[model samples]
Target: MMTNSSKSTLSRGITALVFLALVFVPVIGSRAMVQDLFMVLTLLVLALNWNMLAGFAGLVSVGQQAFVGIGAYAMFGGVILWGWDPLPAILLGGVAAMFLSLPIAFFTFRLNGAYFAIGTWVSAEIVRLSVAQWKALGGGTGTSLPKGTTKDMFGVPQIKDLLGVSSSAAADALTYWLALGLAVVTLLAGYVFLRSRMGLGLQAIRDNVEAARSVGVDPLRLKALVFVLSAFGTGLCGALLFIQITRVSPDAAFSVVDWTAFVIFITVIGGIGTLPGPVVGVLVFYILQRVLADYGTVYLIVLGLIGIVIMLFARKGLWGMFTEKTGIELLPLRHKSLQRSER
Candidate 1:
């Protein structure tokens, strides 16, 4: 039997190897593979943020699509109206989403439980309707990036020269690399935060708000911080995603089904509260998508069924189940107690 330390070392080694392999994918992998992995990485990012919100912070927001849409629209506006480059525009998108979350938090925080969820959904709908009135961005119809917009994006030229690939392929490579970097940063940051004192407080609040407050933990503050931080991450992802597509519409950008439902599905099936759960969930999600994508509504039905099964059988998710059986954790969050020896 492997000791805890040995299992931890093994998990770390495997994780490092996988990350290293992903870094070289653009050089050796085909364009199709790059595109598929880009989607996977972005979804992973979304899943991670959602897991942090619902699973850990107890903020069951159904309006995360609000940040995504705001970020995409902001990026498009930066590029089209302000004549900014796509890279900086993406940053602008994240900032816009972060700012939007302030008012959202202010209002939604007043409600509790399912009411809070509905409040978030209503907030997102309001944002979508408001964005649809911006006539310069094709309003309700939406708009596409101007000609040569992406080809001229920062880093595209350098990437094109280095890879000896066409401008489009280079663009794809640049976005893929960005997505990978974002995923790594988000995962590491989340793990660190969750292991911190504040993270413990956050989890305590989730378990029992009144009990946590008795211990001097500030529930409102931590939940608000998580809300803002998750919005920033989701916004960055939305901006990056729309940049690749080179198009934006309020409906496409703010679709709750795409941005929220699927994300929640991934988190639930993979393992809701565990840090490694989203990664596990995304792999399963990707495989299911590949196999069921051609079957129309059957794909969604299958996904729903799988979610139900997981919830019924493995409440903690697949990762949670695996960890329970194996007594191993790739990213363990439990606090270790110091052993005392008699002198």
Candidate 2:
């Protein structure tokens, strides 16, 4: 027997889960438009993780590509070196990134703002150089994984009937689903933590370190935890990206330009410090890309101009503008309830 409060919470959880499950139906069930949606979902997940780090934690880490490259490399290393399955390898990659983040955090945490950002970029460059020099893992030339490695690693039995995709496509689909799940989980985790006592401390610290410390918050520990988790999330995104390409090279794996640029753009364009902003931004950018994909360099120039214009005129990002104008929010990070609860 559940109390009314418990029942209400359960219902909401169920409803959210059902909605998530529905997102997959069109992809796995429908034939014409599944792949495109899956790709966009993957980008959305990337944007969400970036938002958690830069938007929420106020850590502008340019070397997020470090974790991304590490995760992709870990995928290959785990399967080839340890015979671990792909799914577990992906998780392993995330864990590895988290552990690695500790040392990086220790050093960079001493710096503030722009210096911290520069430190991250320098660290990623070091990683790229090291990987390029190392010959065992194929280095700058990159390496390839066996076909069906992702499916085989995850061990999804009845892949075809269950997913309604061919074996080759199934692997990609599964990776997309994994990214989608992580994005939702990351969002919920952020919301839950923000609502918890610790979240209050973090927010306080973000606002003013001296004030928060006077109130008994440990800024260092909180910042470290967020940095570690941010690395883990970025690494997980990288692993999914590796699954999509089925190949890894130092150049592509450590491609800061793509992962970092896309995520940073999405976070800034959507709304910094807001949960739903990055997701919305990703959708807008994806649509713009799809519509102008064939235009090549011209498309990129236009996007750059739009971004510049937005930065100068509307610095709050797209979601911030939407909130200011319409007051409608599909994802709320600051509040616990979907809508503002009146006392």
Candidate 3:
């Protein structure tokens, strides 16, 4: 039987191999494959951020779409209105989302449980409506990036020259690589944060607010930090996503079904509190999407049914269930006891 150490080593090896393969995909893979994987990576980023907030921080916000929209719109503003490149505009989107989260946290933090969720959704709607009024961006009609904007992005030409690919393909590769980097950074940062002292405090607050307070945990501070950070990540992802598509509309950017509900489904299906849950959930979701694409609304119904089944049978999600049954944790959070000799 493998010990916990051995299991961890094995898991790390497999993860490294998978990421290594992913990194080279843009080089050897077709343009279509790169695009598909880009979608998967962006969804994975959103799922990870949502997991950190709802799963660990105990902030069940249903209005995360607000940040996505804010970020996308901010990026669009940077490119069209300010004449900045999309790469730097992505950072602006993240910063804008982080700032928007402050007011959101101030208000929604006052609510609890179901009320909190509803408050967040309402906040998102307000943001959507407000953004729709920005006539310079085409008001409710939305707008598109200038032609050749992406082709002329900073890294596109270098990628095109190096890979001997068309400008469009090069642009796709650059976006794909950026998405890949973002996913990696988000996952690693989440893992590190979850294992830190503050992370333990956040989880403690989630488990019992009063008890955590008794132990000197600042629930509000920790919760606010997570909310802002998650917003930043979601915003960055949104900007990157729109950059690839080179278009943005308020309705499309802030769609609850696409940005929030799907993310929640991914987190819940994979194992909300576990770090690897989103990764596993995204794979399952992608497979389902591919298999059910032709069935229209039936695809959504199937996703709902699967989510229900998982919640009823395995509330901890697929990754949680696997760890429970196999006693193998690829990413264990619990600290092990020190041996007497070491002590």
In candidate 1, what are the lDDT values of residues 69-133, reduced to their tens digit?
99999999999999999999989989999999999999999999899999999999999999999
Error of 1 at 83 (Å): 1.0
TM-score of 1: 0.97
Given candidate 3, what's the lDDT at residue 250? 91
Per-candidate clash tally: 0, 2, 0
Candidate with better TM-score, 2 vs 3: 3
Q: What is the C-alpha RMSD of each candidate to the true structure, in Å?
A: 1.7, 4.9, 1.7
lDDT of each structure?
A: 0.93, 0.76, 0.93
Candidate 2 residues lying further than 4 Å off, grouped into runs, are 1-22, 25-33, 331-343
Q: On residues 180-296, what C-alpha lDDT tens digit does candidate 3 reach at each position?
A: 999999999998898899998998988889999999999989989999999999999999999998889999999999999999999999998999999999999999999999988
Clash pairs, model 2 backbone: 86-153, 142-249
Lowest lDDT block of 10, candidate 3? 334-343
**Whole-model lDDT for model 3 versus the true structure?**
0.93
Q: Extract clashing residue pairs from model 3.
A: none
